[model samples]
Target: MKRLLVLSLSLLALCAAAALASAPASLLTPDLALERLQRGNERFVSGKMIHPNQDAFRRTTTAKEGQKPFATILGCADSRVPLEVVFDTGVGDLFVVRVAGNVTYFDQAGTIEYGAEHLGANLLVVLGHTRCGAVTAVVKGDHVEGNIPALVANIVPPVEKVKSENPGMDAAALTNKAIEANTWQSIEDLYKQSPIMREMVKAGKVKVVGAIYDVDSGKVNWLGEHPKQQELLALTGGAK
Candidate 1:
């Protein structure tokens, strides 16, 4: 047991060293912030989490100086998908918004805009997760009660899209496809509906990418950036 613990510590140190060895310039660009999160998750999945920025010092510093999170995460409210733990970020490193299925809506867009436009988040991640209850509910057409039903409705379009595309695809495969579809659609909703976010994307100040967290494996699979977002980010200066 003691040897195992020591080995864990050694592995943690190695992951931290690798992350720091080629650190990018100050999380200023969306690509750089994405890379930072990718490295952090690598440490997490390898069981080598440094648990960076979660210390008393970090807590105190964030409290005293206010938050300046480098990334904004729109993730599911699933307890299993604890945003900070999955990304291995800590106090003030991530501005997170959680709702079932990680769907984008008006209020959610406002919150994300505040994070990016005001808080200076260069990276925006629309994170869906595997075996997501919300997507499952929609796929199964469950009779969920109350406002929960409305919440599940948010994920239905993606299911329909997946169904239309895949025809007689199996249930498990359909759910997976729906989750990916939902992730990409949320990214599109954010970029399309929010003029503030659109301007930010055009300026290259923010990049919105889609990802899905593998619930069973504790790994986040980055599904690449949105295409319109790609075109927007490629343009320099002003929102045309």
Candidate 2:
């Protein structure tokens, strides 16, 4: 047992070393990373995707040198919202953390922090999509079973807030508005849960942004940073 433990520790250390050594000295600033994603989505929308970085050479380089992704995406686990395809990003180009509703619960928050802090991804995007079943389920107050309730619980607050603020709105509009609201809520939750992310954003080490992906149109509508970002940052005295 002792020998096995030593072997495992040695392997882990070597992996971490490789990752650190492969990381670029300079990473893309948030604005540039965002622009790249926008351009890729435009190509996807135009049916002209160049599919950058998917070649065998690219694969071998990333596998040997570890990932150097420029952007970290928190997106829904919906089948229609395959983030890499939607953004036209290829291997080693994006660090993606996906969950239903794209909520920033504890595990997802920690994963995102790893992407930004350890992987050197300077851009963090909370991407919600149109016709999101997670948001729709919460808006309709669907009774989910098993572990699903736990997953949907993170979405409840934003869905309820949208409902309260837009009284008498039809179900379709409520769900639509809630989807966007949920994206912002995920950012708020990220800042609330992870001091690392909050400090990173405060120091301009990373930029947190939101967007809504239209599944039907294959276009990403950028919403930029949260409108109440300063207010959210104030939670940790990160507001300037």
Candidate 3:
């Protein structure tokens, strides 16, 4: 047990070192990173995108210097929501993980940990969309084929919660509310599943926020941190 603990600590230190070695000269704080993403989304929404960091020079520079993305996004795999294009960012600007429903399972949480802990990204965004098919399926309890049920299993609880809480809501309203609830559920799953992310967040090294992308308006509606962020952080049982 002692040897295993030492090896785990050693690996963590090595990962931290690699991250620091490749980190940008000026690392953006969590708030600043969030602001940058908001500004980029504004440009995208207004059709005034400057297309930052897409140029050959920027690509070559990032390739040489190594990628140091400022924000890590966990978004839905909806074809309509192109994360970089929606955010108006370019090469090496954002580290992204996409899965249907934007659900945070063990693998998703671990990948998010890599992006935030091992890649030095302080801002973590869970980007769901306004009308997500995966969410819709879960909301309606649609019959799914092989493997798909497993994919959207995590969404069931949130959808059920929404239904139980909003018994008077119509189908459309229930679906809409469930979508938002699922986003929060993903954050909860992250805090529950990934100790790495929980510690980083508790240590003030990472911030996890949620957002919803509107496919029609091309705008990202930011939802800030979870309402019970402090409670979530407290689960880490460590210092900030």
TM-score for each candidate, following the candidate numbering: 0.86, 0.87, 0.86
lDDT of 2 by residue, 123-153 (tens): 9999999999989988988888999998888
What TM-score does candidate 3 reach? 0.86
RMSD of each: 4.9, 13.5, 13.8
lDDT of 1 by residue, 116-147 (tens): 98888888999999999989889988888888
Q: List, residue by residue over 1-240, the lDDT tens digit for candidate 3.
A: 999999999788656533432345257788878877887788789887767777898789988988788999999999999999998788998899999999988788888888887778899999989889999998887899999999998999999999999998998889889989999999988887777787888888999999889889999999989999888877753212
lDDT of 1: 0.83
Error of 1 at 73 (Å): 0.5
Which pairs clash inside model 3?
none
* Clash number by candidate, in order: 0, 0, 0
